[model samples]
Target chain A: MTVQTWTYILVGITFALYIGIAIWSRAGSTKEFYVAGGGVSPLANGMATAADWMSAASFISMAGIIAFAGYDGSVYLMGWTGGYVLLALLLAPYLRKFGKFTVPDFIGDRYYSKTARIVAVFCALIVSFTYVAGQMRGVGLVFSRFLEVDINTGVIIGMIIVLFYAVLGGMKGITYTQVAQYCVLIFAFMVPAIFISIQMTGNPIPQLGMGSTLNDGSGMYLLDKLDGLSTELGFNEYTDGSKSVTDVFMITLALMVGTAGLPHVIVRFFTVKRVKDARKSAGWALLLIAILYTTAPAVSVFARTNMINTVSDQEYASMPAWFKTWEKTKLITFEDKNGDGKIQYVADAKQNELTVDNDIMVLANPEIANLPSWVIALVAAGALAAALSTAAGLLLVISASVSHDLIKKVFKPDISEKGELLAARLSAVVAVVIAGYFGINPPGFVAAVVALAFGLAAASFFPAIVLGIFYKKMNKEGAIAGMVIGISLMIFYMLKFKFGIFDGGKSAVAGLQKDWWFGISPEGFGSIAMLVNFVVSIVILQFTPAPPEDVQEIVEDIRIPSGAGQAVDH
Target chain B: MSDKQKKASAYWRENVRYLFLLLSIWFAVSYGAGILFKEALDTIQIGGFKLGFWFAQQGAIYVFVILIFVYVRLMNKLDKKYGYNE
Candidate 1:
């Protein structure tokens, strides 16, 4: 069968499975909608959280990013996975013991101020929305690129599928759906990686294969060959680091704290049955996520090596079929500026005539390796699964924040459960539409915006949540002041550097070195802002009145596992 | 403070100390071996790759998974010790 035909069959089966799960496990109450009735087993919840966390960025774009960036890409590898360690250790179980439906529920109650809740709600919306828009675009881009459909049609179809599950079963439906998605995406991701790994390296395991010699017995190591190829082509050594050590450190820090702080991921812990289950489930989630995170670097190496061996310095007249196909999509362009018959891939942009989009490396890798057509189709299904699963999770967070946190908890405390559920679904529809709009007509910032979401979460929510958990003295005034200052500084810095605002094309500022503060870009500035948050909160706590006795009691309460309440009982 | 509160505080202190111990390992592997000392570590090869590059991209992730499980085991023991087990 044609690759397109196979994609339809595989993707159709997965879509039907998700809708089936949604209808079968439809949420019956606000409790179910918000936290899957808190009945999910730790292992199941772990899979769901794993699916929710590994978005299109992780599945489709990460290896491509790593392929180009070399060792610098390790920032993403360590930053993302390491953050789970922080989450599992510092936050997850305590939050589960705290027994909350949403992140704001903890923040608002911990600070003992409705104003604090409002501030948290504001942050949640900002983080979720900014993050969701990118997921929506990923959904649309995958559909249009692979399914032979227009971008808008792809986004609307995506919205409908998400609306069905998210609006119907809420977290309950999304949970089971994500479990299925985790299976599909992981299976799909590993197959091609395994094939490519075997094709190049003698080993079957991609991890060991990355550090193994070539299958053809070239006598040279894979990394050694790649380094030689990279330098021959006038590029940095593939094994050598790319970014400055300091920038890599800061970026990794931002991603770590940011992942821990993300509302969508944090909310997943609230699904499992017990405090112990929460801890176990976080471990499970990381083990599951590591399956992909570890495989990604290996895939990056394979794809990079394959491209160089197949394309570079080869005659343009004999350009491969996959290269021609991608060139038609404008993702790969060959200028042949030197008019040399041979294609040259090099570091110098002008000197190198062939420019291939990094995003295409993973999607094109299977084809480049002359793999079977079905593997190509399987990749499409995997990309869709990754994009849709994360989109569904993010949409639920947005919906719950609206219906539960803002409307039911704050504005209309008297609203009925039925009314709140209806509001949640309605808000989800609105959110999907707004997200779809952004996906269809994405701003210039859409690409970098997910990283911005991380920065925002790192600067604002991580400090607030961590302090609220550990520090008994964390009061409303201090929490509020910290969030306001931390988030404001991050926004201002992002505006100054990323969007090129504030300074209006002016050269450099007081604390900045070459338009960057300490050579840290907006993406890495979150770690610094989080530091400022800790310092500011501590300073303010010295002046503000201590939290009430009960608030202190809550801190001590979450510190243990007893009296965690009937978290799994219906 | 009451007797139970005092015990809980001690348990909490031990828990915090354990967290520091684990996090220190986490920091050392990712930030230390991965980034700062990556060049020096690169001089040493592990199989086909540099030790530092391996830590940055693959080794650290593997360690992260291990650490989380270790924390889970330690905390469960702590929970039992504190009579906080479910």
Candidate 2:
């Protein structure tokens, strides 16, 4: 069968499977909608969390980004995975014991102020919306490339599927469907990587293959060979980083703290039954996530080496079938700047003739290696699974915050359970439409938007939740001031540097890098803003009265972890 | 303070101690070895991989997974000792 036929078969089957799971696990009450009835098994919750956490960025764009960035890419690998340690140790168990359905629920009740809760709800919406837009774009990218459809059409299809499951089953539906997605995505990611590893190094394990000698009897190490090819093309060495050490350090810290602070990931703990289960599930989630995270760098090495060998200095007309197909999608374009028939894939912009989108490296890897059509099709299904699972998870947080925190807690205390569930479903539909709009017109690349979402979460949510649990005397005034200032700082920095809004629009972004504050990129500035938040909150606390005695007791009770009852709405 | 409050404080103290130890390792592996001393560590290589590069991309992630499990085991044991396990 052809690649498109295989993609149709595989994608169709996976969609059916997700819809089937959603229907079977359809939620009836607000409890099931918000926290999956607070009874998910640790193993199952771990699988769901892994799927929810690893989005299209990890599955589709990360290896491609690493292939280009070389050693600088380690910031992503370490920063994203290391955050789980902070989550498991500092956040998960205590939050689970607090026994709330949404992250804003914990913030509101712990701070004992509606103002603090409103700030939290606003941050959650912005972060989740920013993150979900990237997922929708990922879905569109996969559909347009594999199914031979328009990217906008692909996004609409993805939004409909996610809306169906997230609205019907809420957390319950998303959880079970995500488990299936985890299986599909992991299998799809590993198969091509393992095949490429064996083809290049005569080794089955990608991790070892990256460190082993090439299979061609050249006896040269893979990393050394890649480094040679890179410098020959005017690029940096594959094993040496070009980014300043401080920028890398700051970006890593931001991503780590942001991962711990993300509302969707933190809320996963509430689904499990006990505090111990929450801790255990975090371990399982990290192990599963680590499997993909560790293998990505190896795949990066392979794809980069293979890409350079195949495409550089090659004749454009004699290019392979896959190149032509990708060209039709406009993701890979060849411009003969010097009127030369040969394609120049060099690092120099003036001389370079070929432009390949970072997303295509993973999606086209199987085809680039002449793998079977079914393998290529499986990658498409895997990419969809990754994008849809994360989108559904983020949508749930959006709905829960709006329906539970804003409407039920603040606006309408006498609202019925059925009315709240209806509200949640309605908000999810609205969220999906907005997300789909962003999908049709993305602000940036998949990984870049996702990374900024982390920064936002790190600036706004991480400190508040940490202090709420760790510092009993963290008053509402301090938290509210900290969150508002921290998030505002993050947004200002992002607009000025990333979008270049403050420094004469997007065209001036390149020139503005030299003016970065303390030499930190916009992506890394979250750590700085988070520090400011901590300082401001602590300083404000001295002038303000301490938290109520009952609030202090609540903090003490969460620390014990003996009687974490079922997650309740009130 | 009451006996229950005192016992809770001790348990909390022990928990904080474990967090400090585990987080220290986490910081050392990723930030310390992976970034700060990466150039120095890159001088040493194993099986065609630079030490610092391995630490940044592979070693640190493996350590993170282990750290979580270790915390889980320690926390579980502490819960039982403090008569807090369900």
* TM-score of every candidate's chain A: 0.97, 0.99
Worst 10 residues of 2 chain A by lDDT: A442-451
Best-fitting candidate, scored by DockQ: 2
- Best candidate per lDDT, number? 2
RMSD of each: 1.9, 1.0
Off by over 4 Å in 1: A503-513, A567-570
Model 2 steric clash pairs: none
Q: Please, what is the TM-score per model?
A: 0.98, 0.99
Residue A227 local lDDT, model 2:
89
| Candidate whose TM-score is highest | 2
Q: Fraction of the real A/B interface contacts present in each candidate? A: 0.95, 0.94
The interface root-mean-square deviation of each model, in the order shown, is 0.7, 0.5
DockQ of the two-chain complex in candidate 2: 0.94
